[model samples]
Target: MKTISQVSIFIENTKGRLANVCGLLGDNNINIKALTIAETPEFGILRVVLNDTEKAKKVLKENGFIAKIAPVVAVEVSDTPGGLAKALKVLADNDINLEYMYGFVEKASEKALMVLKFDNVEKAIDILQKNNVSIVDDKVALGL
Candidate 1:
């Protein structure tokens, strides 16, 4: 899989807070590829993989949202039995520790596109590549 930038925006857990973030992106024509929301009593984190990260972040900051970028891996896993287990085995063998991960499928051909966050990204990528795993490019991951 390829390494990509994941943008996490801090959003207040209120009625229209999420709506505001979505509206901002919608108005700017930015497409969100993969998203995961983690929440607490006070706030929520909107983790997104965007088609245009730079512009999205800039606009979010201008609107007073706290946005940060981090590296994450994207892998196109098979849509069959043991697909995910097989991939995870590769990382386990290589001693790669996964911090967190998320994914989605764009079509019937594939079941999942894995987005992973780990400390040793370079090593993890090298291992996956050598094992012939399909790694998606960060820019391409945005699916613009």
Candidate 2:
């Protein structure tokens, strides 16, 4: 629900390319908090919410990977039925449109973190705040 920085890395859709990215990050001590890959026929877009986004981008670019930074929203919601529905409903009611989103469950946790991309980030954050949603900024999201 709060705006955060997301790094998008475009890499070849071939074996070892993903490993190359991971190795590069690991070697530089960059930590990935959340990640999702959108793959097509020839290429893949790796979207990552990281503890060190600028460094990650630098590492990727130095290694010849196409990397860019963008803003996204991260929300922590209850890990139960209708938890997502309620959050989405708030956005829908506020006329906010989500371009895409991804998330993961924390092992042995009762909450899930969802990373959201939207055309209207500030407006979405405001709405989410008023509704009492757990909105996290980039640092907070990475810490989670």
Worst 10 residues of 2 by lDDT: 104-113
- Cα deviation at 43, candidate 1, in Å, is 1.3
- Candidate 2's C-alpha runs over 4 A off are 104-109
Candidate 1 lDDT score at position 124 = 89
- lDDT score of residue 5 within candidate 2: 84
Residues 17-123, candidate 2, lDDT per residue (tens digit)? 99999889999999877789999989999998888877887888888888889998889888899989899999999898999999942422468889899888888
lDDT digits (tens) for residues 56-114 of candidate 1: 98999998999999988888789788998888999999899988888753531355788
Model 1: residue 9 alpha-carbon error in angstroms: 0.7
Q: Give the candidate number with the greatest lDDT.
A: 1
TM-score of each: 0.90, 0.90
Task: Give the distance in Å from residue 3's predicted Cα in candidate 1 to where it truly belongs.
Answer: 1.5
Q: State candidate 2's TM-score.
A: 0.90
For all candidates in order, the CA lDDT equals 0.84, 0.83
